[model samples]
Target chain A: MTQPTARSGDRFLAAQPRGTGVQSANLADLLERVLDKGIVIAGDIRVNLLDIELLTIKIRLLIASVDRAREMGIDWWEHDPSLSSGKRGLALENRRLRERIGELEAGRTGRRTQSPDADYEDDETPPARPRRTRSTP
Target chain B: MTTPDLTWLYAVARDVEDGALDGLTGVADEPLRTLTVTGLALVVGSVPRSGFDERALQRRLADLQWLEAAVRAHHRVIAELARTGRTLPLRFATLYRDDRGAAAFLRGAGPRLRAALERVADRAEWGVKAYLAGAAPAPADIAAPADRPGTAYLLRRRAQRDALAQRFDEAMAAAREIHAALAALADRAAEHPLQSAEASGRAEPMLLNGAYLVDRERVADFGAAATELGRRFSGVRLELTGPWPPYSFADIGPEVPETVDPAGTGTAETAEADVEADVEAEAGFGADAGPDAATGAAPRIKPPEPRSPEQPAAAEGG
Candidate 1:
């Protein structure tokens, strides 16, 4: 598979054969391992705990923005069963309730569209949200 | 007044030959140097205090660009050293006032560091992450009866959701089975927190984020086992990365107080004895040896013997 976002480091290491101990060039892979793993030794210079927490939050935002750009139109969460099961079910339930409310409103007003039921058929499709892809540094 | 340069310690290892780091540069493009103490080589670099001092580092770490460059540089140096011998990679941004300070740390932490080096010797870490394959299975097309479109739509949606929930359960089961199989083949295994879709840069939900510490000779077998597991479980895709510098396995216990004097002192000697006793205790209980001891930790599975002469060397270095 071609990696469109492969950095120069990845391209350089790609020439090496598999199982040759090449480090991954993926930024996320690097950050996760480097920041989280490794032995902790106290240094003469004291790094504040608050500063580390702030740095972690910043890194998370940076990763989120980068991914948002790369996967502009793909909202995996909407269809992800593991992640959205409860939320998606609730959304479906709410939409059905709203359709019922619309039917009642139309009946009371006596001003119904020719095929109110047919108009609501498209509710099976997920609603499209505006996609925002912010450029990351 | 210009502040003195701080010593940035990258990693610790034994028997790092002379000139092993001849051309290597570390974070801040400083020349790499080895400060040998207690029979361990401390791979280090000199970074300007102006940039690396605690206050400056906290600010610089927030800048993504600077963080990336410095991180990559740090890994590059450690990776190079790892090629030469077993290395205990230190956490990023571990710095000291000078060589003397770094030496003080090594002296205080000597026995623990040595045991860590022994634990990781002739072994490398491999990362295996499993992701659910393919886009969410397109909602199955169960034809809704034409007569009552509204009822049919609702039924169809419910069926689709049900099927998805079932698939999610199956996928999770597959992840656990895969981890068990791989863990059986490794000396040590670690389950890191799963990365978010944003962090993984993949649309698929990550199922397993695992690191395995495999003997150098078994690197090939471990990779093959992962590949076979991927094939057997068609729904999950496995990404195998490394022979990494044993970052996940580099825990050398908590920091020793800097007040402990260099090797000759009573406090340092007593600390060293305590570390030796701890190491012996760990060795006695093979299953409980590592920090990330997996459940049902099998006695260290010896890799199948008979590796090609070139394989070990190739797996050790790029």
Candidate 2:
């Protein structure tokens, strides 16, 4: 355990818990590694008769965390939104919105609308901001 | 009472004390045992085949109660062993046909298993997540001039968009800086994808999900640095958890020779895994794959073993 230290000026010394059980493992912590690391001992329990395979339940297990999974290059969760931060969702949304705006701008150029608001829109002197392709930096 | 049960494997250890696991039990209150092969010790317990059969296993896995109980049991054993000595934990529900099969497998994998154990010796993993605190209530700006309503509206919209972008950049910058500081303290570190709002249950977005493998001796120092980072960036709330088994750093030992595609030609399969995380919502079987909910704990879709004729029909899990 790290003792709480005094902050000197702008430098804030981080506080540490007086007591922490480092040995304990939570469900998330344990599940993180079970699939992407270690020895996967494979065995099959088969029940068969008359030269035909009836049921073959193959048991293959490896323990690993997300980091361990990535070390082995098994990083499917990075692109998966449900299991990850919603950056992927945000990226998709931004892309779709940009496309829609592009389409709208293109259509506006093809036909002059008689709407009264058109003059006000034209007087708007600002150039459109360049589209930002990245949702998360 | 005939128990044509198989051995439910938990973990493999290298230097546990003699009888360190004495009096310990496993899932369903079954007796736990230790089997040693080539100086590597395997921790296992008997799980009746009646409940563990493929059909029954799938059904039980779908039940959160059953899954949680089993995982708790499995983790309890690994945690105890890890506390005592170096251990390599197995995925939930790793089972063998019998003790003889387990022994043979251990013997065959002896070299790789030993290497894996060595890699994790005296090392533990720590989790650090950084979240952006909800943006200061949008800096309540009621100072808009009533005379210029249209200009004010557009200006307000523009300001909101700019503020949003600026906040994101600040959060990302804070996350990167914190991760770098923590990484310096740790022997090795990894950045995991962030958890979603539903999973985290926090309105502020998660900016960083990082795991560090710190030496047991320097854990305190690492923790202190993490705490300092949290304090330094008041805008982002940093969460530090664990000194857990080296779960995120244990892939250095063994290579599944057959599936070892350095080229990562498994794009099709990974896409399938992506779809699996999507279907998890409708499947209701690990639907709450959020970390808070039992690690969103469920078995991942294992690619079909070449030799096995039967595979799980449905692929659902994180």
Candidate 3:
């Protein structure tokens, strides 16, 4: 199985499939395929008095049963940061954190207590008064 | 009287002596008995009654689970058959009320069924799935250029997408070359898969989805060609499976209906199409086109074999 470059077994195996994809199989492809494809028999599971809900249920049962596929499902949503995989939420959360840090930094620049950024502020503004004098009498 | 549930029917070699298949079982854990016709074993079954009504059976097929059980049972036996020798498979969901029914059909099927089975004797089927890998680069969201506003940015992004799209088409071009080389070794094949919804949902693009029915003796050359392609495209994945039954080769033609099952995508469609096509190519393929033989498993339309394999490749590419 080794090529001239002698890549790892994982790489070779990965390349052995019908190679097509932005990346290797994603949750959607894996879920779509493993659940539906392969040599299936026409069974009662395929027949109900009603509608397409069985397909949905089949997916739910299938997703829940496959431990890693489900775990990967969560990862794709969180880590991939795409519209489907929940990446938008991650991006918003990041932006929100950045804003909060900016607000806190602005507050620190002009607090009544010790000003951590006081020295860095080259522009002078008038001081109100001394804090200790008001406390004495 | 009642077998309670549907049982499976299996196809074994006509020459597989009765004692040779002694321990074999059909669907319901029953002893396997061959359905012989003109001294040939047409089928073996686990059915209870000596007969069944076809009209009722068609209605019964609506149950997917029953269908699945029967297919799984059929597949189990077919797989075992492969371990021993070549077998022309019956279409999925084929049933006989009992051995007597199976035998009756075999006897009635006559020369047509015999010729079909013999045509596939000493041969096997192998599956090759070739998908075009990311013919496209990663999606790009280029920042708005300082130079333009209204339509320019949209145009650039569109241009980027189109450029990436061509990459797969190019990969497909090469894959077809490989497919052509492989097809030459086989006696016959199913339709070439073209639909790509799965690959579209995928990160990469799929180029081909195909199956081949070749003589048993040439499996090595087939694998070698595949392995060579694997090496050449070490960049591509060339998924291969089976030496399984002539699931692709068993051809009675499309009398049975097949609903649009899109999962297997292009490959399944082509395989489905090939079932019809191979039959049109020749009759008495070995003689017995078993009862459901003309059903969904065989090719419907047969085209003249090209004077040479190179011509089809040239035609497709051209």
Task: List candidate 2 stretches off by more than 4 Å.
Answer: A1-41, A45-137, B1-3, B134-146, B252-318
Mind giving the per-residue lDDT tens digits that candidate 1 earns over B1-318? Answer: 224899998999886888888888888999988887757789888899999887798667656546756877888888877877889998888998888778777766776787778888888877777776633556668788889977776766676667666665676678789888888888878877666443454546677878888887776666667766776776677776776888888887656443344564465424233232222213222443444555223321221222223345764342
Computed on alpha carbons, the lDDT of every model, listed in order, comes to 0.62, 0.52, 0.43
Show how many residue pairs clash in every candidate, following the order shown: 0, 11, 51
The CAPRI classification for model 1 reads as: incorrect
Using DockQ as the measure, which candidate wins? 1
lDDT of 3 by residue, A1-137 (tens): 11233322233233322221213323333322222222233322122121112222222212222233354343332222221333343233333323333343344443343322332122222122211111100
Candidate 1 residue spans exceeding 4 A from truth = A1-23, A48-137, B1-3, B135-144, B256-265, B269-318
Single out the weakest 10-residue window by summed lDDT for candidate 2 chain B. Answer: B276-285
**In model 1 chain B, where is the ten-residue run with the lowest total lDDT?**
B299-308
Tens-place lDDT per residue, model 1, A64-134, is 32234235432333422332455454344334333443443345445562322343323433222211111
Model 2, B112-149: lDDT tens digits are 56655766678876778776654343633856899998
**Number of the top-ranking candidate, with lDDT as the measure:** 1
Per-candidate DockQ vs. reference: 0.19, 0.08, 0.02
Evaluate residue A41 in candidate 1 and report its C-alpha lDDT on the 0 to 100 scale: 69
TM-score of 1: 0.67
User: Of the candidates numbered 1 and 2, which has the greater TM-score value?
Assistant: 1
**Global Cα lDDT for candidate 1:** 0.62
lDDT for A72 (candidate 2): 46
Clashing pairs in model 1, backbone N/Cα/C closer than 3 A = none
